[model samples]
Target: MRAFICAAAFILLAVPAWCGNIRLENKKVRFIFESRHGGLVSMEDLGQRRTISSAGGAPVWEITIGGRKVTGNAFSSFTHRQTAPGRLVMTWKGWPEAKNKDITVTVTVRLREQEALSDWHLAVEGTNGDQVPGIVFPQIGGLQHTTGTNLAVPNWMGELLANPGEQLKKPGAKFEWFYPGHLSMQLVALYDQRGGLYAAADDTAAYRKNLGVQLGADKKLVYYMVNYPDQTPGRQGYSMPYNAVVGAFTGDWISAAELYRQWGEKQSWCRQSRLHGNKVAGWLKSTALWVWNRGTSAEVLEPATDLQQRLGLPVNVLWHWWHGCSYDDGFPEYVPPREGREPFMAAVKKAQAQGVRSLVYMNQIQWGNSTASWKTQHAERYSVKNADGQPASHVYNIFTGKALTNMCIVTDFWKNTYAGLSDTVLNTYGVDGVYMDQTCLTRMCYDPSHGHPLGGGNYWVPNSGRLSDQIRARVRNGKEITLSGEGVGEAWMPYVDAFLALQVSRERYAGVHGWQAIPFFQVVYHPYALAYGNYSSLLTPPYDALWPAEHRPANMLQPLDTAFNRQFLLEQARSFAWGMQPMIANYKPLLATERKEEIDYLLQLARVRNNSLKYLLYGTYRRAPRMAVPEERFPMSRLSIYAGQKDKVTAFEQTYPTIYHSAWSAADGTLGIALASVQQRPYAVDMQLKAADYGLGNSGKIYLVHAAGRRELGSYAGGTVKVRFELAPREVCLVEVTPE
Candidate 1:
């Protein structure tokens, strides 16, 4: 075996070696490259005393060009040179015959001044009808076979791959981000017990290609970029300008997240000022109630008002299925059903009189089949087209058996329609704002006729921002009008006041391996925009009465399954801890139904978030410190509702010590902590609060409040305050610490 290994290494190093080996070092990391093979041999995290590299003979860069597999070993010549202090550049040139013609490829790898990051660029010349498929880093070692090693990717909310080797063997096992869908964010991180590595593609460049991460057959991790086809067939001298940041960190996933956060902050989209000021902030502090009533608009008003009065909290009411046509039956035609405009407007006025804000529903992407505008006028000119030039449509309402063709956001027809809807809802309907559906959730359109990029690129993100600005400009009489969408994406931050944040849940396909869902999105854009829990029974059913028996869809009404009870409460607790506004779906029937205990649980959680709005809504979120606990158990289950066989469900365990705790500091420099017990049984959590941990003096007094009964838990003073507190099942506790 040793002799065979040595022979393979010798064969891989057959090319001329300009420089035998090159070492690039900085204060944080050290990277070693083999010149002859043109591959990274060693990646060392200096502080953690760990090396992340394969056994040997592994190629760092692999590409498929001109129907030929080209790897680092395929290069006939190589040169390594130090361009600047702490920066090294390795260049490789090669020629491969395709269709009896030589295709020249030049690859450059530059280790940037930041020791943890490297930039790879490829240039291809003399291409005669030969296409470039992708470029991949085939082997990133120390990411597999380790006990604590995990892979983190931004999938729905975020995904963590714990059992790397086992996970890779699953069918269709890959993290893909192509344009036009839920791939709003592009980032991946692999970390272990010792340290971790973080990598992210340039978002601007990634739109032209597919960015992804997968595991090879040998169990090594791989990240690759698949280039798009040339617009003009038979074109030559194609230069794919793709760049990535590869870095090493010493802690858990948060350290790697910090790297991406710092990069995102410098982007142009994030720099734009938000649309609304204090009014938006006030809206963020309120809990949102999502109503999908099949009844009259007047029927929704009383329930929304009662819920606000009962909870003593403001509410943002999102009214769905209130249109004149059937549910999701028509788009850009938002006339009220049965009751018509007068009753709908009256309902909105009554809700506002009771201090409740209403937001009418609008579908941002879809042009419904039932609508006359789509059938008679703009389907060809406005609808999105697939790769086969077929119109893109989705079955938004399964029961209706109708499909809605997706609209190209960049088109003048869509812009004008959306702007008109915004004006009608805000001005005519007298609603406070618009709850635009699928605004950030839909995939990018590849409609060539729309005059945007062939596939989705940076166009959609900024265009959505412009639409938000246009709507805000039409706010009548300085009424606090807010704009919110289905989901949160970094690009929509400046435009949107809040996001439904439906991705943060215990559903299937949420993550990989035994991954636990964390506040990764909040860590980046918490104070900038508010996130609300998805409207579902997982938190609280939205209605006051039972679900209408005859009209209920078969899949809509779930069985009284006791198995998910504990998991449901835990998800709600996590939402509050992560600084998101807790929301209830279909509240009218829910409040009048038999689920009184569930309603109480939701109210308690809401009160906790409401009382600590200063810290959670306004202040910046800090990473929850690792707590010492006894026998931590992470449970996994099969998803009851799964689209494919590969889908699996994993439950997040927020037990004592590490119990769903989020720490923050308010504008007044007062440190606060929100903690909760998500289990079915009560738990006594021992907490050690250090003043210095919260940016305070060595000594201080920490005040505690139990949000359930609005009871004061007393104050303790010292440099380190050790306190033991008992919490009821699904109970939340809030603490405020001040330096004395």
Candidate 2:
């Protein structure tokens, strides 16, 4: 028995233990950012004296930053939580071990106030321990493939990380602006497989050789090398050629709270806050609703007139569509007007009179096929060749042996095309703005036939100065143009005012399992299959027309159905739009008719959003009224959205009762409690409102109230209201019981 006990004791002692240790000094404070004059921002109060220490065990850490601490703990990686006013605390636990020691770990916090965009860096020395040195890179991943694969790989081979071997080294790293509010940061720490006294020697020179930084179209921010200990300048890693596949830029210790805050502040319009709208971004102050149509002369004219009649002056709407083969269309061969441009120019005149912004679309590159005489003449000058040395087919000039098209935007042929097109639109049409579509296809051509004498392929390929020069010319032509396209990744951030990102796959959903891994900085609109029943197709022409002309007969009267939880769907869309960044409506098959139910629902939601648009435009947003996910232990039962008080909101249930809950006010009027029903069915909620709720009543308008789609409610003063809803599988109902 004694021998057995001794053996058990030995076994227990030999088992591995995994944990982390963290220490915070008294002088430490949370980092904060604020805006300065001239549309510029700065990071300040970071240099406050602070001490950080850590012990390594597992390779992951739980760090939290907040204005104050709370008794009920929420584990959010390593972020600071705001518990009270003016107090900030950052906490971290469970970090990986560093090199050479039984316990590898060290933590250092830098407090610096910098005016430049990329001004922060951190470095760790070779310490005795088993901790893995890690670095946090900034910037939403680089431009993604339109194929819906979001891997941050570039089009060119040498544009990004060239040698993985040198990535894990002790070479010094630098940070810079890849796009506005997006950063490019790099760090190096040795990875240890075993505990030791001195970490293995790292070839710092090799690591430095691989360093590279990419700026946006415009150099909006200056690059800065942060001064820190244990960092030396040496070329250790290889400088990749352009268009290389760099890994995705995942947020490390830094939380995106500041990004959210800035977005909120920029959303203000008409002196009201509109951040609560379902959709918003870095550009638009709040969500607004109006009809949209393609750029056909008849359609643009009719819709512009109709919208102006209903929505008042300054229509603030869009006239979208390109008359010729669109950017998405298979061909991009530039064709001059079949007629003398009389009809198209007349359409532009009518649209401008009605106060509409007309956006034209066209393929940035030429299709190999020559549909027009001009295109046939310039075939050799424009189209990329296929692997067989033939001109590429379909919409692409397959210069890379791949099916994708490469635009010779810089070639003399392209310059002529653009100049002619600009002249037609600007001088003759008097259009407000130009929408250059699908410039996103700018990439390297791999085919030897289309290769530049200097070896240019995609935008990522190491090239002669030709491609860059062409880009400068297109925008420099003295006409105001709004550049847009799908998957306009970080690589193109600086050039475009709004980013039309394509959230194509299931993996791209903001609610997906690990959605946090991807970031959308500018305004981005996710495209959904309208006919798939997930979203309302009200904005598009009736779905019956969606099928190919030969596929089926049209079904025009689908009797606008509000019963499909249309209200909640709009809310979800609005939320997502604003949540990601600046963006525009991406409804395809641009519809002709106005689905009034959908329009009213969006407009009401917009009314609420408009109130706080200013604050939301420039403010950071937290995923609030917390969304419940499968991985979570507790599914959300109830939700209450608050701006300031409880009085303002339109509450509703759009789905199964199991998915939503009702709310009740507490006795002291200080709290609102939301409860979810256990069963999936219709239910009623009783709410207590404060005049300040949702910034309503403050706006002095009778706020719109809705639940599901059958009913509407309004409130003049703070009071208790009973709300009922018909729940759907997954839906959200916004309430505006207050004024605004």
Candidate 3:
């Protein structure tokens, strides 16, 4: 680590005043602060020779207390001193009165020798009755020039805002997991041609409030770190104990992600995934089949068995709408099977015999208004309360106009209800697993009556985990039981064995300014939890027609079927590249239609994914170099042409190597590369590889395995091998390199 000490640069006397400013410099970056206004004057990326802040702009720290704005420049007195060798502390006292309160703000900035990152710690203390609504930081005015720049906002199921301000703005979006709800990786990055800037919080406790980013009317990007501190009429302080890092990197968006990944790897939360070793390898062989039908015992069993036989692989049935009530009509109430418990168990047992596991679906977040108990009992007491003390409601059945009130997971009533329900389901049905819907999808509760804190904290995650554990303990001895959730949530990773990932499909990337969906979540938690890919029914005509009208929500919009099918195939290929299990729902309805090509494509991908289980499923994911291929390879399909749609199908055609590649390595010295083609036509991709690239010697054999069979591509002679192969449309190719 390199260090620069300038003892004589600033006055060392008691007042310590050469100028009312201080500058901190490192090898890669420089930070200049104004003492009078307590604002960041400039942040210079020395390597790029660019400054992120404006000449005389407002400081990065903007505070709002009790609905009143308090700018750092409004403070009456400002003082600064060097706290440590690489650290500086700035304090401001006697701020202008806001919301009838006297306030003080303190900020600490630290820069390390070896890192291009700076850590910031902020504290706001008040002496009167006032509550804090939010805080903004590192206000870079240069972000207004949004020509080549991109902002990345992390969401559950790994969605990002690649084109930030261009998309339709929805303010107050909640980013959760450590703070509450689900999918809280707790990092945001902005990048352009001149490197990038990454900001993140390591402390989950201070991050409990709702966090969001918005493009202000001034065109500057603003961050909202919402907090709900109590308004006590005494000297009280709201302190952020965890340090926030704002770092610069030289590259594109991927480089920004790598910086955050490095910081995330050091946190304790990233290391808690329980799935490792043989457990991860076993999940690769498993495929999930979701059934959403109101049918008799035989109606469900026949199709599940057929899929198992057709695929010639292990399949699991995630049974929905098997109860007596209408689909999603009742919640916290698992009705007895329509035909009877005996027949239900018979169907489950029959499927289990054919290597099919049955998992019952239960709603974990809402209390159905249609339930008989809710009408008679005081269910609102257990529901989530907003800041205004009103219950939160979710409309589940739009046709019938039935809604479910969101429940507070921390309540005793919620815990008892789920515990009893799980016992009945597990012990009575003897199923292999349980699928909990909305387990971590909803926002945190601020209900004061829940016996927890007044404001939201980390109570929701641990309480939800306890509920999952209580249910898992009910499985009979010697029988393996799996716990699955609706979507991926980092806090729920330790409790869930699998996630029905609905966000990994193409529909998530369908808008004009929509982001290019990637498997970032899998890159972090692939070994810990198995993510089952979801397909959009809007893509396949027959599947879309089969959707029940009563079950369809108002927000559901159907895209063109032909264009959807094309993108759907590309999404499946991407999913496989990202180490996710293929999930096909409404199996019976879709199979009855004449969609043989789509079915075959799905089966081939599934077979290949299971076949290359060792590398695709268990190995750690690494970014692979781009493969060179022809520019204009194939023509656009006529199927994409539709009435009232003048837009050219954004799907790639002639692009070289239209294949997604993921590199991996295992502890047993096994090196592997998995590739999935996004192109619709058969094409050959040439890969240039060297043994040293994978930590191998000059002599080694590389085997290319696909549905056709495994064959030796060639051996590396002078430490290099140029392998060429043709992949069928939507085919997955696994290359295994063994050293001699």
Candidate 2 wrongly placed segments (more than 4 Å)? 1-291, 316-322, 325-340, 366-370, 373-375, 384-404, 410-412, 447-481, 491-493, 501-519, 522-536, 539-553, 556-568, 575-595, 616-618, 622-740
TM-score, every prediction: 0.84, 0.44, 0.86
Task: State the lDDT of candidate 3 residue by residue for 1-740, as single tens digits.
Answer: 11122345344422222344677778878887765665666677787888654434446677776677777777777777776666887777776566543577888889978777888888887636565645554443334436576766556556555556565256653222234444446666667767666666666442364455566555555544444443323436677656677767787555665566666555444465545523322422455334432255565566777776777877666666566555455676675866678888888887777777767777887787777978676788888887777888867553455778888877878877887777777777777777888875645566766777555445667778788777766656756777778767666766677777765553433432345466666665565566774653322112112234544333222343454454455556667777777665445534434456666666777777777776676666665645763333432222211111223335444222367677776556667788877666887767777668767677778888776667888776787756677777767778877788
Superposition TM-score, candidate 1 onto the true structure: 0.84
| lDDT computed for candidate 3 | 0.62
Measured with C-alpha atoms, the lDDT of residue 200 in candidate 2 is: 10
lDDT of each: 0.62, 0.29, 0.62
List model 2 lDDT by residue over 525-644, tens digit each: 111100001122332132112113453324332332334333333333433323322122323222224354344434433343333322223332222233332211222111111011
Output the better candidate (2/3) by lDDT: 3
lDDT of candidate 1 over 233-294, digit per residue (tens): 35565565546556676666666666677776666545652522444745545653333333
User: Cα RMSDs of all predictions?
Assistant: 5.8, 17.9, 5.5
